[model samples]
Target: MSRRRQRVGALAAGSVVVCALGAPVAFAAPATTSEITGNGAWVAQAYENTATGIYLTPQQSDVEGPARAPFGSGSHRMVIGESTVQTELYRTPKYDGTPLADITRLEYSTFARRTNGAGALRQPTFLRLNVDKDGDGDQDEQLFFFPANNTDQQAVANGVWQHWVVTGSGLLNVGGDAGAGSATTLAAYKTANPAAELINNDDPADGTATTADGGSIALITGGGNGGGTDSQANGEYFVDRVVVGLDGVDTLFDLGPAAAVQTVATSGATVTPSNLQGWYHEAYDAVDYLDSNQAFVDGPGATPAGGGALRFALSTTTNPDRVELFRTTQFDGTLVRDLRTLKFSTFQRATGANTTPQQPVYLRLSVDTNGDGGMDDTLFYAPANNGTVAQSTWQSWDAASGVWGVNGDQGNGSVTLAEYVVAHPDAVIVKNAYQDRPGGGVAFLVGASGASQMNGEYFLDDVTIGSVDAATGRTSSAKRFDLDSVAPAVSVGDARVLEGNSGTVLNFPVALSRAVPRAVAVDFATVAGTATAGQDFTAASGILTIPAGANSGSITVKVASDKVREPHEALSVKLTARDYGTLGKAVGAGSILNDDTKVALELGKAAKHRVEASVKTKAPVAKATVKLFRVVKGKNVRVLKDELSKKGRLSTVLDEQFEKGTKVKLFAKVRTPHGVYVSETVRHTVR
Candidate 1:
């Protein structure tokens, strides 16, 4: 099958690239759509060649099985970078009109084979992306460091597929193996640098000097220093499905194929009644009550209409034996303090011909206002007014009316139910203790006073506690609304970065879906990305107030300054949700690009007999390899080399031949995770 096509200029969004077999494709979108024919690939640039080891193929082998093509259908891409994948020239425009800086995530499939023979360590292949993420000329270098001896390395290297989604600032080796492989599924990995920032970048090769033009994607074997020494780049590896998100991506495009959403779904603060809180019952001369689930009771078509219901039954006990269900622990002075009305649904029936109904049925709610050993306030519902009833049936209560029967049906001590609710608004404890016989703690079946053992059956459903509304002075809705437990949405502006030594203020906005009657305060903290707290920027934590009826509020986070010359860095400000509304995950990114003039070690004649070399880097470096070479016919021939001292300083005595001033020169190379940085060769005669 012959597949040849002519292409000119930079690759466009819809430019189709024909593959030798299977399909033809473009780089605009995911290959899931049928419009993209054949396989996974884009028309590579004419200048790109496999001989230099930067081989990028859309698909390696289109096998018809799940074992291959883990991306989607057809073939997945294969990217082999033997230290020659240019990072500056790959910056092409996209369909969404998105630039690389707006990207959030990049994901791709990669695998490495275990080395043979003893001490067979898995060869570490550095996978990274987001080259020049800040749109600055310099590339923010992040290394996905794979441990040489991971426990799951064999399985991953043994044909088991793995995927990585890169994000985070300077995602340069945040640590650990990307992930282990699974037989039935493709292993997942986070290829994004979480702490990626323009700050604390230790490598100068990642600076402007190395950019092809201004931007490009970089994937290479081993960590190439751009001056040879890419030893780790020689290993055999399988990499396909190249993806990159400028910041964070979801639909997968300019963002890498498998990157997760840029922002996480937000949630509001919530207070829900945990199950097993208590639907309790006790036996006093009474064996078992409803005995339905041996816990509470269940019935059909009850009250507020949810599903089923709970029925309360009593055995033939002494007239007024009393049992109760307490709202203990649940009423621990938080969202609910002084509840106005304790609503409930109940059904009373008369058995056979005993039309007397069961007198004195008393249901009461008490509040421990002062936490003083006993309940200081009480509200009781007495159905004794209606006296007795005839037939047995189901009916709704405490729903629309917010009361058991009628108003004025409750009283405790001269204070009526309405007055008690207003008095103890801050009660610490509330209980449902229907005084059975009137002692310190009365007997069970207090409602069935002087009646037969089984006075028919009384059923209760949808028992709720309605608190007094702060604005309306009464319970707003009978159902007490589920408190709208949905999590709140959160967003932080993208432009909150520190420019140089200006010490800009990083502000995070906190907003709510609907205006709350009461003010909601959220806490904010400094989260480290590539930038570290105390070192790169100042660490801060405080409250952000969203006043009543206000949609948004701001938290002003203070950024710091330093004299260290480094690459552009990133920092994140996090917001914490408290009592009122849900706390959302709104992170404000802080970028700190170097504003000071960066200086590298200069090697040249310092004295009449000795050559002195000195340097100042992004951070402290150790054991730097310094080379002193003699210029022989324009070729650099090594004469002698030594490592720099702790202060990043080097001094050496030149060869006897150089003592005569042949215009000899020397250069220094600093090894870093991104790659080795070669200094500009200094030409000077040494004695």
Candidate 2:
């Protein structure tokens, strides 16, 4: 029969409790939204079957007996007539079992009874399996069948119920019979008939027997009279010791209502927990773990509520020597909503250990706000380990004083205003820190509220929370890198000056302690000197090099323009250093422009000169060679050697060289490669 067609009924004292009779059964309570966020724990009720055992009274249709022990119910009893019974099963949150996969084996023990002088009553039984395979809250597969034992049996006597039962297990065949004797092993049964049907039994004789296997079978009942009398009720069957085998096991982390748990494994690597809310770091020291346990409560009711202790086991080979804890919490105590806590416990171990120590591990606790997976608030406690006792009470932040402080009181501490503002400028104050110390135990309390409390990012690293030195008594803050130690220095050498000239070199000196990726620019400006339109003085090279770790270097400056006449002009040479670091910041000097002196000159009158002339010829003289000569102080002097022409003419300036009233004689000579030619003497007088 189909799963929807199966029905289950409970035979109570003079009453029948019908559970799933072609209807949906609700075994678990509906989950609420608040419970889903806070507690994350829920479970379904247990399912009971009452119609599969012996009857207490012959006249009564229902069976009742001694109370059951395991689940705190009554004795094993069932109705004695032909009827249909159904029971509803539910899913539980904390059961240590696996999800039902393929069916492995189904075995149950039952006792049959034939009564009322009947010619061996015949009864056929059916079983149904239900599952929400599609996640649609409905049963998917149904497995139903009749037993193979529906045959004739000899009754012990008439008008009395005789017991004839099958207590051993066996596989159900397609025809609903004990498939080739009784089933002794699950693997053998599964291998025999891969598509076996449900087991059912029908006996024609009035027989009664007790069955020990009661927990395996889901539902069992009897119907269909044997003698074809349409009596509708005759024989009865009792079931017990029902055992079903299935696949994997379930973990406790899957207890929440719609909660999902993911497992990850790594070797020789640091583990960082991510995508968490309302908590700080997932690792902590031992002392901090104890402190947080005292300060915070699990859920609203606080009794058998949601939160509980979290445990972690290290590998056998890990022998940790030291450990630390980290957490994330809101800096400001305001914005209490969306608050979460993450606890981390770490241990340091030896290099070549095969087994770890049994005791002495560190623990810590942290709180996260804004949901950024980082802890904004953290608490630390150092527990007694290896016979060492802890002396400090508790460590927390002081927002008012803007520092971390210690509190000795056991009650919850107050909010720290100043420190909170520095860490979270936009946060609002909600709750403060509180601690409890009794019986040599320490606890720290933290509370707060603000807008979007469940939003933001937070993180934690390995460090102390609020410990201060006894001598100094100063709190510590986070560390960060000085940009003010970089400057530039420059120097200019002596300027070379040339009279009435330009284009001179001016040298410069630069010093640096290290090599830098930077560009140096040098510019020359006229300070006081003026240059003529035609004269040009310019900077020859604008870039300079400072070798790596070099103390000093020289740069040449060119003067392309001339200085003016008035006051001596000066040229300003500016050197700019770009991209300087700490060493460069030490020097603050720039380009220096200075002046050099220059002088002017004047022109004088013209002087007189003398001239004589001569000429030589290679071929016959086709033309005459005239010689031009000058005389000084009545002495003859030659200026021009000769003048070659068809006819020669000569003139000389003798008066300019001689005094007034002086007479002079001028002569000339001409020669060729073949011979020589001489001209007659000429006389000139100066007056």
Candidate 3:
């Protein structure tokens, strides 16, 4: 005889209920839909004796009694047969109230082997989760799986392995319960059933456990005995730890940082918020809070019945070039509001020294009052160049016919009222407003453009519609530039001969109008009657020192020797100032010189018996001519050759050679366009 024992009761939470066979009483609920929020809460209540009926189909039709038990405490045996079983529990919405719509998911995996020395042959067995709706006995919905095999089990001798999978709806399926292998397999009973969620759970030899968190039950088998008997008759399978909820909600269901929620109390008044709400999800769609770039409607407290006001203070390193406010209904797609506009302020220098002065800044307001995203009204203030404010109103876009106007009059200041009507077709009444201090304010809209003024040092207080307005007072408009104002001045001092009497030393004082000085340059004359512009003079402790003995006083300072210099030409030196707030035009006086003409060269030669002469010049030297004469018996004899080239240099081979102990004289005459300058006669001896 076979003995059976059963226990029936609710395990814990209101999630699962179980009943013993042939018992009138049944367990109600152990886990509820709301209590299964955390992990491990539903594990104890998952398994129960819930099967309704079981049918077995053997592989061989002529097989007799049940197969012998190869590894078990009892005499029950197993047979090689296909089986189909149905559970009594009616699958609903799991633990959550959200309906489990479709099971578009399934899977299977495990380790197994044959018992009769021959490899086990897998026959398909379907596992299905049936739902009985409308109190009908027939299942209205079912998640089924077709037969699956474990052909990879031949590698290990009943080794352990694990495998699992997840569906599109986040369902997890795991299979690894039978310890090793038996006749346990999974199959889908329905062929045309809608797609359902399923996954495999097979344990590996590495000792890692696989879980089936949100899927249906798993199928596993016990390992066969060495005596060719199936040992899967009395083994128990475990199905624990299940969860169901919205995707990504398990981590982010709490309210974000506490936000200040305020209400508006005026009509026809613009309302702005202090803090902006970022992107968020509400139900199936994402949403975002209001932006500062859009026109707003007052809630309930302005002149009209439905108006309110809001204000925000902002600061940035760069000036507030522009600011815009916008409102929208959807967060993912285009904005719902048809009107989009921007208002901005321009800045200018106000006060301070020319090198480091303060600048004054002003604001300009423009708007596209109509639905189109184009500017219809423009107002500008010139703080630096222009002394007055400018206003313009123009009509261009047509919302009705979708045609734009070409000749619309754009008026300035008071005359702009007539143009405002055509410009902002959607605006009932357009008005420009200005506030100077705490309570003093004026309306400057349309014809009142010049009436609204904010002068002197005043804060831009709140622009509210009612008594409950939040306005902050402006303190000062003073700003300064980070620069030096005074221009740099350089002077060339007197020259002192440091090395030889022929060498010259130059000195000068470089004074800066401002305490902060940048750089300076100096130049010197060369001995070859030319300016050597390759030399550089660097500033050290606000002073540039040049050695007087270098290159024999042929060194001159190269001014402005930056990378972009002309080939051999030197840069001209000048005293100039830069980076001053309002003093960029200021400069100091400095001295420069053209001292190349002051240098002289001397040459010497050995005394000789016969004489010859030659002369050369770099620049064109006008002259009467070159003459070579010899002294014979105290009487001078003139040579036959006498010629002058365009250049100053002259060479002459003597026609007659002088006798030993004879003296020779060579003279050169240089003539300018004005007059002729004679050179001292030079005499050379010929060997």
Clashes of each: 57, 128, 82
Please report, in order, the local distance difference test score of every candidate based on alpha carbons.
0.39, 0.28, 0.25
lDDT of 1 by residue, 609-682 (tens): 56655554445455666555555778978766677577655555554443555565665555543345566677
Candidate 1 Cα misplacement greater than 4 A, ranges: 1-499, 599-687
Worst 10-residue lDDT window for candidate 1 reads 13-22
Q: Would you give me the overall lDDT of model 3?
A: 0.25
User: Highest TM-score: which candidate?
Assistant: 1
Instruction: Give the higher-lDDT candidate: 2 or 3.
Output: 2
Q: Which has the better TM-score: candidate 1, or candidate 2?
A: 1
Q: TM-scores for all candidates? A: 0.25, 0.21, 0.19
Candidate 3 vs. true structure, TM-score: 0.19
Candidate maximizing lDDT:
1
Task: Give the least accurate 10-residue stretch of model 2, judged by summed lDDT.
Answer: 13-22
Ranking by lDDT: 1, 2, 3
Q: Mind giving the per-residue lDDT tens digits that candidate 3 earns over 1-687?
A: 112232212111111111111122221111111221122221111221223212222111111111211101011112231122211111122322222333322322222234334444322222334333333333344343222323232232232222222233212122322322332222222222223232212212123445232323322232223122333322222111122233211110111112222333322211223222221111000111112322222211111111122111122221121122221111111111111211112221212222222222222233334434433333222222222322211111112111111111111111121122222223221122112111111111111111121111111112211111112111111111111112223333232211112222233233322221122223322221122433422221222322221111112232322222123222222322222111221222222232211111111233343333565532344343444444455665666345456655565455555566444555544433323334455555445
What lDDT would candidate 1 get against the real structure?
A: 0.39
